[model samples]
Target: MNENEKIREEILNTVNGLSDEQLNANPEKGRWSIIQVLDHLYLMERAITKSIADKLKSDERVQAVDKPIELTVNRDVKVEAPSYVVPSDSFQTLDEVKDKLAESRSAFVQLVHNADENDLEQKSFPHPLFKDLSLKQWIPFVGFHEKRHLLQIEELKSKL
Candidate 1:
């Protein structure tokens, strides 16, 4: 399996048996619940996949920087979610979150399969925190983003 697929599998495995209470309970007043984190991850994945697909179809291409991956993968720096990608209380159950994540991940995998290797490196999309990133970088960014939240989920679980 590819790195992206491995990461996706790991995330699904990590949250496989979480109850609704566990998923929705926030560890602290200002902190996000596991469900909220998953929702944000789904939103970000869907948005990033769409952005990369759009960029691939467009005639425009931008020079991608190498630093975006570094910045995104760095766990020490906490970056706030953009307004558009922020999670809401819309998800009432863990099943609902799982459905959305499955749909988004399927679309993401399809986009990756359909894209050319050259185009993956050439096409660029705007990231809220890191600015423009190539399709290649964006795929892995999804994984890293999930991994980051996995740590949060673990912390939340501990508090429960």
Candidate 2:
């Protein structure tokens, strides 16, 4: 979680000077804008947090092997964003997205801090590409996922 916080701070610093218009500008026809990327991160975090909470409260226990989830940061292999996590095209301010991000992160942190490590390791959830991932792995996976988009955000900023 410390590492995740560092990455999150880096992301915020990366966009510190930009205007809202720059954040919302699309780099190309098919690509997402910077704000959209941030929004996607927020949505993904919230969804993962909820899923973890659900699994923790359930009696189901499916042990899963740890995956190379760090591979998530590799941009060479393109994975489509799940529809639920896809960001809207509407313009959004950084503060708006940041608030959403904060709320999601707060919930995620609270859940993680309260959850038992053994419970997290015993439960599993399916990832589209990674198959069934343990809840234990899902925690850091969020950070890796954010790191992936941080690179994308940098690219989008360059184009803007």
Candidate 3:
């Protein structure tokens, strides 16, 4: 399997069998709960997929940066989630969040599969933190983003 698939599986494994209470409990003040993190992940995934689709349909092309993945996956630089992608309290249960996450992941995987390999390196979109990233870079960036939140989830879980 590819890196995306591997990371997807890891994400599922990380959150699997978590109780609603565990998912909703905040580890500390002014921090996100496990479900909130999942909600953010789903929101960002959908947004990124839409961004890539829009860029693919456009006639514009941009230069692919060297080591774009390195720039995105760096954990040292803290970035705030844009208001558009922030998670809401609409999801009442862990199951609801998981269902949306599964749907978003399916859409993201399909988008990656349907994209042209050659075009992936040519097309670009603005990342909240990384400025501009090619389609190819964005795919793995999703997994890396998930992994970052996975650590947060683990920390939240420990607090319970």
Candidate 4:
């Protein structure tokens, strides 16, 4: 969790000082802007946090081996974003996106802090690319997911 928060702070800092126009400008046709990437991160975090909470509450339990989820940071492999986690096309400011990210992170942090470590270790959920990942792994998976997008954000900024 400590590492997760640190990565999140780094992500926020990466966008610091950019004007709203720059943040929201599309680097190229069909490509996401910086704010879009941030919005996607917020949406993904909220969905994952909700899924974790639901999985924790349910009786369904599945055991899975630990996956090399750290590979999530690799940009070589391209994975399409799931429709549910996709960001909206609406323009957004840095502060707006930051608030959304904060809200989602708050829910995620609360869920993990209150959850039983044993339960987190025992249960599992399916990731699009990673297949079934342990609930415990999903915690840091959020950070890795963001780290992946952070690179994208940097790329978008470079183009702008």
Candidate 5:
């Protein structure tokens, strides 16, 4: 399959077997559960859609200081995104979140395929954590972001 298709399949495979408790576990004070992570995925898909569809500036921002430009640069963001993401809403149930995640992920893949040179060339708003993640660079970030959560979910599962 092509690059977008490969990314789509990888996402489809990664999030397949989450449990309710695992989805609900907040991990720490004011953190997201797997369900929230799924929701964030959906939220991200929306952001990508908007960003690509019209070159629309990110109408949204993560919590904390909103260092969106971090996406454009290269920094270790695995810690910062979680640290800054103040949940706008409570975590939904696993079934609900995953269902939407699947759909949104497909949309994300479609968006990636539709991207042009500028989309790939233009960097994400500077993120507080990572830096230099241009649109093209962010492709891996898209997958990596989910994988990071999947690992977190699994680690949380190990304790349970």
Candidate 6:
């Protein structure tokens, strides 16, 4: 397997065995439950697929995304997605989240291998806390972000 595929397999393996409670529990108020996190992550993967496959262009006016565990907690923003921020949602069940994640993760791993180098470098996307970032940076961010959240989930599980 390729490097991207290897990384994907490792990450997906981690996600596969999550218990229902572990997947559905929220770490904090106004925060995403584990299920929500998976859906949101799937949402992000779709956006990335668009970027890489379509050779997308960003309008300067488009908002940015923030960091992992990244909450804007900002009262000022009213946009559908905070400019430069990841969206959080409340998914009803772990099964629902996992279903979507399975699709998104497969597509994402494929995109990483198929991505055009130029598109990866030239495009910029909004981050919630951090400002704009390139596709190259964003790809790795997905892995790092997932791993971080999994760590959070594991910690929460241990406490239970």
Q: Name the top lDDT candidate.
A: 2
What's the distance in Å from true for residue 93, model 2? Answer: 0.4
Model 2 scores a C-alpha lDDT of: 0.94
Clashes (backbone N, CA, C under 3 Å), per candidate, total 0, 0, 0, 0, 16, 16
Best-to-worst ranking by lDDT: 2, 4, 1, 3, 6, 5
Error (Å) of candidate 3 at residue 77 is 3.0
lDDT of 3 by residue, 2-97 (tens): 766676677678778877777777769888877888899889999989998998899899956845564544557777889978887553586787
Q: How far does residue 102 in candidate 6 sit from its true spot (Å)? A: 1.7
Judging by TM-score, tell me the better candidate of 3 and 5: 3
Measure candidate 3: CA RMSD. Answer: 1.9
lDDT of 6 at 139: 73
Q: Kindly indicate the candidate among 1 and 6 with the higher TM-score.
A: 1
Evaluate model 5: give its lDDT. 0.55
Error of 5 at 135 (Å): 1.4
> Candidate 1: lDDT over CA atoms?
0.80
CA lDDT of each prediction against the hidden true structure = 0.80, 0.94, 0.79, 0.93, 0.55, 0.58
lDDT string for model 1 (23-83, tens) is 8887799888888988888899899888888888988878697554645556688887889
Q: Name the better of 3 and 5 by lDDT.
A: 3
Q: Write the per-residue lDDT of candidate 6 for residues 1-160, one digit (tens) a residue.
A: 1443454455456656767776677667665555655566577667766655554544333333434423322324332543323645444565676577678778777776776676667666655555676666677766655555555445554543
Per-residue lDDT of 33 in model 2: 91
**Candidate 3 weakest ten by summed lDDT:** 66-75
For residue 15, give model 1's deviation from the true position in Å.
2.4
Clashing residue pairs in candidate 2 are: none
Alpha-carbon runs more than 4 Å astray in model 3: 71-74
Model 6 gets an lDDT of: 0.58
Which is the winner by lDDT between candidate 4 and candidate 6? 4
